[model samples]
Target: MLLLTLYIIGITAEAMTGALSAGRKQMDTFGVIIIACVTALGGGSVRDVLLGSYPLTWVAHPEYMVITSVAAVVTIAIAPVFRYLRKLFLMLDAVGLVTFAIIATQKTLDLGHGIIIASIMAVVTGVFGGVLRDILCNDVPLVFRKEIYGSIALMVALLYHSLTTLLHVPMDYAVIITLVAGVLVRIAAIGFKLDMPQFKYNSPEH
Candidate 1:
């Protein structure tokens, strides 16, 4: 139940961010809705496909799509106030990232996968939606440029795996601890402007 609740929140947060991206591009309503849905669901879809998990979440629960669409509309209505909610959005995104990672890790473990693949799928599930959003928005993918997004997902996966598998911690406790730790690490990365070193190269004239 906790995972289900967090899943809804994750998609709504992602959908709102997607709507904001579309608004920045001045897209029509349909474009905004499409981007929002894609941004909210694309990561999980990709993860499922790669893991051979049939019946994707949005497919099985069509209401998730409805929820994402509604979120997009609401975001459009409040577009004017988005600038003031930048930090709030960032924090929500942090929560969404950790939530997605935890859910993906659980799914992978349920499928009898080891921690390694679960960790990879966690990162994919947490970050690929934003990557698709950026690609559609014609911006550099934030995972590649912004503060430690994917790394936080990886950390969440590893921490969750260690707690549940190695330490024999209860699943609920593992989820709560991993979620809090992941969110704090991500927010700290944002607050401290922490990121992986950039690779910059100027090519010789072609």
Candidate 2:
């Protein structure tokens, strides 16, 4: 139940971000809705396909789509206030990322998969939706940037897996710990401008 609630919040937050991206590109309402839905659900869909999990979340529960669509429309309605809420949006996005990672890790484990695969799927589910959103918006994918986005996802996955699988922590406690830690790390990274070292390559002119 906890995971389900967080999952809904994550998807709604993600949809708002996607709607913002679409608005930046001056897309129409229909386009905004499409991008929002894709960004909110694309990662999980990809993960399920890769893991061979039948009946995707949105497929199993169409209400999720309705929720995402409503969130997107609300985003569009309140687009003007976004400038003041940039930090808030980032915080929400971080929450979404961590929640997605924890949920994906749990899902993979429940599917009888090992921790390594769970970690991988967690990263995928945390970032792939944003990747698709960026591609659609013609912006650079954030995971490729020198930020701690994907790293946070992997960290959340590993921590959750360790707490539950190795240390035998209860699911609720593990989820709470992982979510708080991941969100703090992500916000700190953003606030401090901490990122992985860039790999710069220069070619000499012949």
Candidate 3:
């Protein structure tokens, strides 16, 4: 139930982001739909494949795809009303990241994985779809650039592992801690205009 809720929230956020971004780029309805679907399902598809879970989540359920499509259409139609969609996208994405990170960590732990593996899987689940969507749209992935995106994922996973194993915290408490930490970090990042350090490479010898 918890996992399903997280998945739904993540998909909704992804759909909104895709719709806004695609509409901004002047994509047609079909293009918007495609981007939304890709954004919503890309990460879960990769995670399921890696975990050897056949038929993928959306493939088996199918409702997720339908919901994503509808969300894209609605977002596109309402784009004008939501003039600050870029800010909305950032907020929703932050919530979705926290939800996905917690879900991934719990799921991996349930599958009897080690802490390290769970943490890695958590990051993958939290950021992979956004990465794919940005790459396909010819933009830098948020996880790889601006804000403390990947760090939020990593911190959430580590907190889950630490609270659970070291302090022998209950799963529920661990999940709460993970979610709170992630959300706080994300909110702080946005509130303070936080950004990751950038590299400046020397020009190649001519």
lDDT of each: 0.90, 0.91, 0.79
Task: Look at candidate 2 and tell me the lDDT of residue 148.
Answer: 75
Residue 203 shift from truth in candidate 1, angstroms: 5.1
Poorly placed runs, candidate 1 (over 4 Å): 202-206
**Per-residue lDDT of 1-206 in model 1, one digit per residue for the tens?**
88788788889999999998999899999999999999999999999999889899899999999999999999998888988988988888888889999999989999999999999999899889988889988999867675377888899999999999899999889988998898889878877888788888899978
Report model 1's TM-score to 2 decimal places: 0.94
lDDT per residue, candidate 2, 55-165, as tens digits? 998999999999999999999988888889988888888888999999999999999999999999998998899898988888998678834778998999899999998
By summed lDDT, the worst window of 10 consecutive residues in model 3 runs over 142-151
lDDT of 3 by residue, 1-206 (tens): 66567668778988878777787778899989988888877876777778786778788999999999999999887878777566766677877888777777777788788878777877787778878788778887756674376778878888877888899998776766777777778988879888877878899988
Model 3 stretches astray by more than 4 angstroms: 84-89, 203-206
> RMSD, model 1, all Cα superposed?
1.7
